[model samples]
Target: MPEVLDARALNRATLARQLLLDRADLPVLDAVTHLCGLQAQEPQEPFVGLWSRLRAFDPAALSDLLTGRRVVRTHLMRRTVHLVTSDDLLAWRTRHDAMLRQRVLGVYRTELDGVDLGELAAAGRAVMADGEPRSMPELARAVAGRWPEPGVRALGEMLVAALIPMVQLPPRGVWRVKAGVRNVPVSSWLGREPDPPAPDGDPVGETLVRRYLAAYGPAATADLRAWSGLAGLPAAVAAIRDELVSFRDERGRELLDLPGAPRPDPDTPAPVRFLPAFDNAILGYHDRGRIIDDEHRGLSVAGERVVLVDGRVSATWTVRDGVVATTPLRKFTRAEEAAVAGEERKLTAFLSGGDDQPTA
Candidate 1:
């Protein structure tokens, strides 16, 4: 019989892997890589995500990484913009190509019915070859004459998001800077194309499996698919099955993890941490019952910032008029309330660049 890991055990293990149980003394690049990239659609939210997981994390350093092209914001992993290492964007883009196309088609199939995708891709590349970044709308308009049948929105989404591997340029994802997205091919930005897909046994897929497990382990295959938005990893999982350790959740679902990955005790302490909207710790699972209650599960997809007390989502947080405030989902003990307030103070200080502020 597989050992059963109940909700609390699963929650602690997740927190440990996510670097929330203890803030890691790791560089920003290393932390970003380890987490397999932060979901960065909101742009500013990743700064808060990194802040909660890393000790002494300099928000400027992440901005530097973005501007320096060591890290990029691109569509990957669920067809969403993520702040991933340049190398990861290069290595993983091809693997995600099929999924990306399918997702776009899922949204715009009727609109693109007669469009020749290959021809469209070539047109996109040609327009982007000018060595300048263009927004999705701008690029779409440039090529709309060629395929006037499809609307610019459909054309641009397919071109920028699926047909061509592209990155959102700097000052857009830069810390505290608000800018509209301007995109160029991933090759134009990185100076190389995506790594060729492995002709053999899905080497990139295998690597994704390991990386996902290392960061989000003791997770079911369904959870893996949910996080990645890829439905083609069964072969990769089979290839790696012998190298993994398995346990069952209380719900009788099998969970797999890297053999040496951390699985902390359920009774282990979890600090009060405020998570940014769309954080992976909540969205990365098929079953989030480990860290968030079923009734409040809608909050994750709704993009609410949440406060975790004892490793569970216990409250929603927001800033209003330069003050941090939280609304509780459940009752808090006095100690828990104190801890949340203290953490919020630290967060406020971090957000405001250590400026002293009046208590909320």
Candidate 2:
């Protein structure tokens, strides 16, 4: 019989892995890599995401990393724009190519009828090859002569999102900067082609499984697929199952995790954490009962910025008139309220760059 781990147990382990338990002292780049990447569709969200997980995180450092090319914002993992390290982008992009294409097509298939994806990809790549950052509309219009039926949105969705590996250049994701997405090919931006898929074995897939568990584990396979947006990891999971240990959640779903990964005691103290909208800690799992209640699950996908009190979703937060305002989902204990208030003050300072005023 597999050992049974309850929700609180999973919550503690998850918090430990997510660097929310004790803020990580790692460099931003290393932290980004370790967590695989931060979901960055909302350009400014990753800054708050980092602020919550890192010790004394400097938003300027993140901006510098983006400008310095140490990190890139690109479409990956569930087909969302993610702020990932350059190496992770090159190493993982190829593995995600098919999934990316399928994801784009899932929405645009009818419009894309009669279009040759190979030709479209070539066209998109050629337009991007001129070393200019092109917006999605600009890229799509450039190729519209070749495939007008798909419309700019559908064509651009496929081209920039899937067919060509593209990245959102700096200023779009640079801290405190509000900018539109302008894209260049991943190869052109990074000065290297993506690592080709392994012909003989599934090394990358195995690595993804290992990395996923190290970061988000004691998780079910469904949770893995939900996080990765890749459907083809069963073989990868099987290929490395023996190297993993298994446990069962209270719901009796089998959870797989790396042997030495931390599974903190259920009673471990959790600090109040204010997560940015669409945070990975909440959205990364198919079953989020460990960290959020089922009734409140919609909040995660609905883009509600949540406050975690005692390691559970306790309230929703927003910046109201430069104040860090919170609305409780359930009444908070006095201690929890104080913890939340104290953290919000620090967060306001962080978000405002010590201005004592909240931004966003």
Candidate 3:
């Protein structure tokens, strides 16, 4: 029989596993791979995400990782931009290619109708082969002869957003620095092409299951599907069930996790964690009620950054005029307010590059 873990048990376990209960000591590259990846469509979001989870995280470390080619930002899982390790990005990009293309078509089917995607990809690659950094608009205009009807915005959005394996180049991802996006081929950016699909078939799905369990486990296959946006991973989980331990949430949902992963005591005290917009620690699971209440669950999808007080989202926050401003979703006790203030102070310093200004 699966052990039934109540919401508190699950919450504490999730906090421990996600490195929110305590800041982690892992390197940025290793941390990126461990967390699967950080949602980074907004460019600067991953820095805040890292700052929240890592002890003494330097924004420059991630920036250097991007420039050093150790980590890369690309559209991968669910066709959203993520800051993923270079090795993981290369290995995983091909597997996601089909899904990425399908999602793009789903959105722009009418506009792309009668347009040959193969020819478009070929032309896009030929244009990128020159190694000059081109914005999406420039690339679209370069190939305007083939499908000029979509206009530059639509054409560029489709190509960079879906069709090609491209990386938004630096200065784009530099810490605290704002720059316009310019595109470069992933192969050119990383200096090695993404791994070819396995002749034995994609074991990446299986690997992803293991990794997810290690980092976000005691989770269900539904949770896995939610985290990955991949519909075909039950077979992957099934293939590795013998290597995993099974349990049940209080809801009687079956959960799978690595046997030795930290399932902290339900009473383990959790610290305040200021999560970045769309951080996967909350967005990673299908049943987020374990970490966030349903009443405020809309905040997760709406991209409102959250404040994890005692492992639950007790407040929402925003930064303006160099102040980390917060409003409680629930009333806070004096202790909770102190904790939130301390974390906000840290966040303000991070946002301001160690300026001594206090959080508003």
Candidate 4:
């Protein structure tokens, strides 16, 4: 019989793996890969995500990665812009290609009716083969002559998002820098081609499961599905289940965790940590009640950045004038406020590049 771990046990395990229990001494590249690529749709959010997890994390290190072509911002995993390692983007992109295409088409299938997808894919690739960075609209307009009636918005979205493996160019992800998205092929950016698709079943899927468990485990198959947006991973999980440890959640759902991974005591002291909007540590699971309250669970989907007090969300936070301002979702005691403010000060320094700032 699998031991049933309650919500608090799951939350502590999550915190330990996510590096919130204690700041990890991991390299930036490893950290990005570990978290399955920070939810980077908002561009600057990954920096905060890293800062909260790593001790003395420099925003410039991430910027250097972008400039060095070591990391890339691309559409993958649920059709969102994630700042993934170049190696991961290469190894994992091909596996996600079908899902990416289907998702984009799901939104624009009506708009793109009668379009020959094969010819469109060929033309889009031909256009991107030139090794130039082009905005989605620009790339779409360039191909609009052939697919004239598809509308530029639909065409551009399909090409840049689904058909092509393109990286959002630098300055878009540069530290404290603002720039519009311009895309170049992943091949052009990294000087290497993407990994070929698995000859049979997805080998990459198996790897994804292992990596996910190492970072966020004691998780169920549903949590794995929610995190990757991949259907039919149960086979992958089942294939590897013998290699993993099994437990049950409070709800009796079987959970799989890495054997050597941290599962701290439920009563372990967890300091206050401020999470960025769309932080996957909380959002990656199907049952988020382990780390967030049921009533406030909607906030994660809504992209509201939250403050974790005693390892559970007690407030929401936003930035104004480089100050991290907290609004208590539930009234906090003085000690909790002090802990939150102290952590907020650290967050402010990270955001402001080592400058001391007030945390209101």
- The C-alpha TM-scores of every prediction are 0.98, 0.98, 0.95, 0.96
Candidate number with the higher lDDT (1 or 2): 1
Candidate 1 lDDT tens digits, 211-239: 99998889999999999999999999999
lDDT digits (tens) for residues 23-118 of candidate 4: 888899989988878889998999888888887687889999999999999998888889999999999998888888888889999889999888
Look at candidate 4 and give me any clashing residue pairs.
none
Ranking by lDDT: 1, 2, 4, 3
Q: CA lDDT of each candidate?
A: 0.92, 0.91, 0.86, 0.88
Off by over 4 Å in 2: 355-360
Q: Residue 344: error of model 1 in Å?
A: 0.9
Which pairs in model 3 have colliding backbones? none
Off by over 4 Å in 3: 355-360
Model 4 bad stretches (over 4 Å): 355-360
lDDT of prediction 3:
0.86
RMSD in angstroms, all models?
Answer: 2.2, 2.2, 2.4, 2.1
Tens-digit per-residue lDDT, 38-90, candidate 3: 89878898988888778778778899998888888788888888888888988
Tens-place lDDT per residue, model 2, 57-137, is: 888889999998889999999999899999999999999999999999899889998898999988888888789999999
Best by lDDT: 1
Q: Quote model 2's TM-score.
A: 0.98
TM-score of 4: 0.96
